[model samples]
Target: MTDRTPGFATLAVHAGAQPDPTTGARATPIYQTTSFVFNDADHAASLFGLQAFGNIYTRITNPTTSVLEERVAALEGGTAALATASGHAAQLVVMQQLLMPGDEFIAARKLYGGSINQFTHAFKSFGWNVVWADPDDIGSFQRAVTPKTKAIFIESIANPAGSITDIEAIAEVARNAGVPLIVDNTLATPYLIRPIDHGADIVVHSLTKFLGGHGNSLGGIIVDAGTFDWSKDGKYPMLSEPRPEYHGLKLQETFGNFSFAIACRVLGLRDLGPALSPFNAFLLMTGIETLPLRMQKHCENAKAIAEFLSTHKAVSAVNYSGLASSKYNALARKYAPKGAGAVFTFSLKGGYQAGVDLVSNLKLFSHLANVGDTRSLVIHPASTTHSQLDDAQKTAAGAAPDMVRVSIGIEDKEDLIADLDEALGG
Candidate 1:
């Protein structure tokens, strides 16, 4: 290795990983176990107290998951990260650190359907309120903010719609409100957009999607940008206050820049117990190695297909940021000039029933609710993912009755287009 910083591709393959010490294995080996045997009593005590960083239990941490966390942190350019069982778990851990009962967080309305459901319903059960804001209008975020606002959440590239967000603009609102900005970079991935590079204090991902590349593993991560001043206004007590569990140690005072990650691990993950499996972590890490290669192909295939859909007679609209006519194209060029990403929605002239029929007719594209698989996938969001939302809510989330979303894979562009053509023709 040279003195110069490693490029994105190099980081994808080599960051946070090396030959196994036990067998000199080139690839990272899964440390699949429930607990670790400390060398001495003091060693175990130090680990349990967070005095030293070492594995104690799989529920809190594991060597395999640690590598995944470190690799994701390096890719996202965050100071530290925590791996979770799933993306929703990542959000839960993050919000747990920032919000108390009856507190609030501002969220962009344009988000993944699963996230919308989790924020609106699941968080409400915990007394954590969600204030919905329009990502298209930055002023909405500012107006939604109140004294109780703990954080602001937005997707880097919104799901289904593939629209670009004004992260810097909304980040300003968070800064003025003295709240951290949380950006879900699952759709864009770090390969396309590093939200931390553009004023994001925290970045979250559903590794089930592109990061895992294949539909083989389910995982999530929370990355601490190490830029937020959690102690400045004392808004986040989880970080700023003393902890009885760790013998009254103040996390922010103790861990400094990466305190947020530590808090999520010690307080949230340790108790909530949404631990990622070591085998899943191993698979996800392997998927990340070829992220640079897979992501580029995903983007290229997506842009071509979006172009094809734009011209199809059955299509009323194509909601892809890569398309020049899209409302988010200018922002895309500014934020993600590399490519727009793979998952995008298009409206059919035939509306709701047509959407269902398209998915039914498609031969190559599998009909599924999930996205970011190596195989092309299709879904009628209004009927499946966004079914819980009402008409107005569905429209707001960009999952209109007429919309059909597709996650373009690394397969041949012509084949994908032909499949879409045949489906629409039927």
Candidate 2:
């Protein structure tokens, strides 16, 4: 077949995949084996030593997962990508590759509750400190930067609250500081926005969300934009300096622009062992094929829901970026013009108990921690996801006691609205 530049839909289905060379299988077969066969001792040695890029173990790489990685990279306009067992695993790998003990990173306060815990508590054990900045204040990111700061992290559309970050502004901050800007594009998938095109040096995703739209798989991917020059200021010694593990070869010198991918694979995945399963990779690929279609409907439904909630007597405030009155509406238009995404939060006029009652009363919306599924989801963040945080922290992160988050799905708009109406009445 002739090589043709494929569009988003075509690449989602065909990129990083071809018929199996050995068996001529049309489907991406899960190489379920623990390891691969080498031609001889030298071949095995080269693979193990990282002299050649081949699967040494299932924990390091798998053929099925590789296709998923490549497809995600292409979709995100990234040079390469690494698949991991979970979104949390992907974040850990990125931190391990870029940060050393005593290094710091800046992140938006409006982030996933799990990510906040990972950055503030778990990452603290590694001697990496996170400086929190308000997503609305671009100058706050610049002010938070210290000499020890190595990276800047933000969610393209923050979890629960649906706040949209100014990727270009944040990227500028990182650029001025000579560091990489990392964005979590889980809520706003590549179909809505590709962070790399907006100046992000690296993009991360919880494929368990929209990319794995069925909510049947748990996976994550880190994509390298291949635009940042690690050797420019020698800040990232891990990439710019020689590594004894690979016979003292410098990653940037050897791998050029795609060195970040090589570093994550060789140093992070090889040591950390958070490899994504081939079965889950297959599931995620299936979901990604219809991502554009599902996301469009998701946004449309969410806009309707947000509009309804804003005018409702029971709702004190609505935080959907699609709404004209939303604090993030301008940023949404700038970064995600296609749609403001599905996940959003609103405050109940009746307070915490009413929020809980409403969640329980809803029939169509599933009360779950996940988002981006075909089915609508609801959660009381203060009682569930952000319960661990203190009152002060909870308010700072926009998870108040009266707050209820909704992940609008492709369900019938009227049905969703009626469910919310009945729930609010109760």
Candidate 3:
């Protein structure tokens, strides 16, 4: 075969997949068994000692989930990947290996509401502290980093507002601080912006969103770019120091480029126990086969709806990056030129009551909590998703009390526009 590199569309359907040798099945078969048999006594011992690459149990590894991990890694341009039960699980697994008790990480204030809550409250229980920085001001990240900082985290296309973070600039800060830059690329996906290409050391995703596309599955993944020097400052003992579980084997020394993925699997997932089910893995893989197509439609429909809202009398402001007048337009053009993505927020003229009324009045849009579904969905973030945050925290996250967020789908643009127009008193 020729050594021609496959395009994104080609990789979406074919990466890490092969026909079954025995059954000759074209689709990936779900290996439903919980435990895999070893070759013999020696083989079992080797697998247990981390000397072999075979699976022993479903909790640690499985064939179906392995395919999902490999496919996501290939798409995100990373050395290796690990899948988890959900986006929250993915975040937990990642920080577990990087932070010890009382260590800190810098995070952009413009993040998903759930993530803000997780980092602020849930992570604090483990003695991990999150220092907030503004994405609009690149210097904020630099100022937030201290001696205790181990990583910097941001989103490619932020939720609720669809603002684009300056990935390259923040990556620079992480480099000088001797810390890894972790980017959550769930909003843009690899189809739009590859975080690794912009100097991200690690890329993460909530596969349940754009990757799944149908909103039918719950999954998340972490891609190790193999760019960070985990052993350099001796900050990350989980990878640099000898591991007692593996008989004094140092992960970075042994696995080299992909050691982070290995540490997460054998150390984090093993103890945290947030395993992605093989059945969900099968569904997520199938969903990824058409990501390119679904994302295109999602972007096209979102831009059109944003334009409609920008000119409407009932709307005070629209926060879509695709709009030329939006504050985030230039950053969006630099990072996601194809389109600004499907989720964004618009403020209503009448205030918080109007935002709630608009979602109730809309016919085509489903009033729900989720995004990146085949059908369009809408929600008032201040009342639903971002309700837990205080007044200042909600505003910082782009989820203002008088704002309405929408996730456009693969529907006809005219139909979506019509729904918005009627809802806004056409």
Which residues of candidate 2, in runs, are more than 4 Å off? 1-4, 387-393
* lDDT to native, each model: 0.93, 0.90, 0.92
Q: Please, what are the lDDT tens digits per residue for candidate 2 over residues 234-342? A: 7888899999888888999888878898899889998889989889998998888888889999999999999999999999999998999987888888888999999
Give Cα distance to truth, residue 104, candidate 2, Å.
1.0
Query: Against the hidden reference, what TM-scores do the models get?
Result: 0.97, 0.96, 0.97
lDDT of candidate 1 over 1-426, digit per residue (tens): 567998999999888898987899988999989999999999999998899988899999998899999999999999999999999999999999999999999999888878989999999999999999999999999999898999999999996688899999999999999999999999999999999999999999999999998999999999999999988888888999899888899999999999999999999999999999999999999999999999999999999999999999999988899999999999999999999999998899999999988989999999988899999999898998778889898786677899998999999999999999999993
Per-prediction RMSD in angstroms? 1.4, 1.7, 1.3
Model 1 lDDT, full chain set:
0.93
- Using lDDT as the measure, which candidate wins? 1
Off by over 4 Å in 3: 386-397
Q: Please report how far candidate 1 places residue 416 from its true position, in Å.
A: 0.8
lDDT by residue (tens digit), candidate 3, 1-426: 988999998889988889876798989999888899999999999999999989999888998899899999999999999999998899999999999989999999888878989999999999999999998899999999899999999999987688999999999999999999999999998999999999999898899999988989999999999998899979999999999988899999999999999999999999899999999999999999999999999999999889888889988999999999988899999999988999998898888788878888999999998888989999998888778989787786677888998899998999999988998889
Candidate 2 lDDT score at position 386: 78
